[model samples]
Target: MIRIAISAALLASAAPVLAETHSIEPGDGAQERLQEALILAEPGDEIVLAAGRYHITDGLSLDVDGVTVRGAGMDGTVLDFTGQQGAGEGLLVTSDNVTLRDFAVENPKGDGIKSKGADNIVYHRIRVTWTRGPHEENGAYAIYPVESTGVLVDGVKVTGASDAGIYVGQSSKITVRNSIAEANVAGIEIENSRDALVEHNIATRNTGGILIFDLPNLPVMGGGNVIVRNNLVVANDTPNFAPPGNIVAGVRRGTGIMVMANDNVLVEGNLLSGNPTAPIMVIAYVQPYDDERYNPLPREVVVGENTIEDGGYDPQLDGADMLKAAFGGELPPIMWDGLGSLYVSGDTPGWTLGLTEQGKGLGDAQPAPLAAPAPAADFDETGIGAPAELDERLG
Candidate 1:
């Protein structure tokens, strides 16, 4: 009896120690209630979800500071955006220090999950798909984060996202590793971001595999996008159907390693092969042909020590035709080692992987001063396109 009393006392003491955890069932407007859960969740709360389908139309939003949401498992839990009333964005998270792991989101009207203005967020072992398969208007991204920082996205599998799979735009201090992306408009694009480490990512069978771009037309400048050691980035054949009678530029078509207006960027220790066109590209977006830019002034870009196993351009073909076929007509032909029996487009002038004088020019080996990296505090993850000052990472 005394021993039983002691056990009861111990159990009572431990009861308060248990952290609060909540569960939301399938039919409970799981999408709407997700917001409530975030409101109620404390720093370290876990929100466990049951194994069932949650149709998200309005979508799940998060502003909570720090929380962890885990599904039963990737296959064990499914968040279906199918047949939802309006456009579906399965989950949109805009919080800091959050984690959403081990779940499946499908057929989101927009991007499956867009984590904007976020920091230190992790989407681990998550799967995104479109059950209806690859539709041009299906959704933009499987997992898209903008202006985020200190993020780690791993163990993600994305299929049939319309725009891109796993797009990180304007983020800093990020890492995207051990993920697989396939059958999307573009696979794994890191745009206008800085100090990012991308490794061990498999981008295959998509329109563009493993792209890093600094879209120059925008008012805000974009630079410092990096691509690091990774596995296969091969043949990106998938392309959205063209609008009737309209032709889009191949400079924007199926490719591997697309970078423009990016500096101090690194592409090393990677295997890029079997692209229908150039397996690796460093192309100039339609910049001015005159005045102060090279073959005029100087801009910086770096492409180093990567194994180009097979495939590149066929410039004898009409550049327009080649682009429709997905050859980014960025760089001119090259000196073929003759290992693959592929003719080098060396006949075409002014484009080389490194600096050039006429087209796609950064000029000969003159170096841009190595700028210092910025601290995390100055780079805000909560705001969109914060001012790019020298003190910040974009600086």
Candidate 2:
């Protein structure tokens, strides 16, 4: 009897442990069913959505660690939150080791999908968008991951955000690749974040193509070690329609890429074209904020081997009038605001802007000192930074 019991136990241990799968079909009360599944889900559970549209009124949240929520495909499975009332986001994830894939979320009131304070989260083949065109009332961000570590956003498409399309803020070890962002205020913004790689993405017709920014009064202050390579940023001449109080509202239109107040950033091997403003701009975080903890300088920035074409045709001479005046309204491929005190080459105390090799059709690099101090009125009226508020809300 003991030998038989031992053999049975060994067999049981050798069998694979199967995770529970909760499948939700498209029908009335589907959102409730999804919420119930999430409430009852334990670790290693999988929630699968059917290949149809689910009209969700309230936002859905998943807090179970090591759980996966997937759909049939990005095109087949749709979560439409057009009339959402209860939640500020379509889906909120606050669990570790979570994977969300193969789904489309649309038209949330605040943000499309947000993951907060989670580690090892993966969003793959997911689409978040507004069916309507770009408007200020659209959600602030699509596919936003904040204060999270080991996050990967791959093969995603985002559009019609009032702020950024794919925004990764205050996070570490992040990667956003093979993504498409368009018709947003700023596409693919990495703010107050570190150790990120953004590559193989296409950003077009946005206010600004890609922005690496570090704002003040955030828990995560300085951002560094970011690489943006092999991306196509073109024709980002959409007018800035962000709400008046937001910081991105100050972003000039027709800008291809803007790097503000970050360190150790590299922009290389990208194809940029047809931006009316400058193709690449490097400037300090000159906003008037009283945060002593914030480092406002951008250091160790390398702009290497990027193909630029037909830029500086009609520049948006909004904030930096000095740049427009100095370049005679025809800006160069790369424009740097000489704000750094560190010496780069032979007694020239300017920002460490490096251009190793230039591509064809790019104008000369124009690194000039700021003509005057930034005006205090240029700061956004919203006193508290949005990212800090978002962090508090996520917490």
Candidate 3:
């Protein structure tokens, strides 16, 4: 009997720990309390932030896998980093299978919430804002996820990011939907990522609404297989406010949707209006690149049928007056650099720079009306978007 009891006790001790909730409220020493809760959380545990504004001094980090960080609501629970003295971001997560939901981060000094190498992460109903709006000194990216796979960012709102409002880089199997990005340099950006679905997002009043780029010399290369559809990209006329040395600083204002150096990209079913530049732009990477693995030209890009209105009426390009006159008072809705293979699914009007090679100037451009073939067939959408299981967490 004694031996049996000892064995039963050992078995109970070896069982998995029951998940617990750590509740934190905003008040004096909230910074320490919040940090401690995050640090002490175990896998399959939750840290709940109560409804109030948490005045944080330094960045908060979470390295525990399978942890959920919940807050009252995006508007009810605020993490104000206005007085932040240190750290490169407001919150950093380096673990996998983590869920962050219903929180607001305001005035982060650098990037707002960055998840690096955190796979299977979900960011839901979160808001990040720069109160002053559209300044070069604002945070570089509001919601940033890099070097990870299986990312889902849904129902999030971001504003006034100097670089990008919602940025996913070096990741795969990503989905960004039901989000609003406004007053940012690049509203929504997918950089050096593969198999991404960007849909049902509102991108407005930014320098560039949606940018899909594949740049050289990154840890991940060959961004491709992206689907951008059902988005409202309008009036992206905010001046370029990115830091002078950033690549996005060169992005012309009023660009609705720009795809550069990516392969197998599909742009369709979007509502684009009031973008003074081309509503849809497909271009090659013009900068000189040393990476042999990088393909600087866009390939197999298909611009399907989309609702475009009042675009290219006040282009921000050089010799806009001449181009307008040449195109009968307004340029086409679509603009291409004419360096790679592009197909328009329908009869959407377009124009091209008609450059023979990358790194060519506009002076070398033989500007002409876009003459591209229709897509051979429907774009293959297999294996795109975030994993379906990420939505289960929201329930």
lDDT of every model, 2 decimals: 0.61, 0.78, 0.95
Sorted by TM-score (best first), the order is 3, 2, 1
TM-scores of the models, in the given order? 0.71, 0.82, 0.96
Best by TM-score: 3
Best-matching candidate per lDDT: 3
Q: Which whole-number lDDT from 0 to 100 does residue 176 have in model 2?
A: 84
Off by over 4 Å in 3: 1-14
CA displacement after TM-score superposition, residue 128 of candidate 1 (Å): 1.4
Candidate 2 per-residue lDDT, tens place, 100-183, comes to 889999889989999999887888889998989799999999999999877788888999999999999999888788899999
* Model 2: residue 242 alpha-carbon error in angstroms: 0.5
lDDT of 1 by residue, 218-309 (tens): 33344564545655787666664222221112333446665555554555557876565556555444345333322212133434446665
Q: By TM-score, is 1 or 3 better?
A: 3
Residue-wise lDDT of candidate 3 within 298-372, one digit each (tens)?
A: 999999999998769989888999999999999999999999999998789999999998998788888999999
TM-score of 1: 0.71
Residue pairs with backbone atoms closer than 3 Å in model 3 (clashes): none
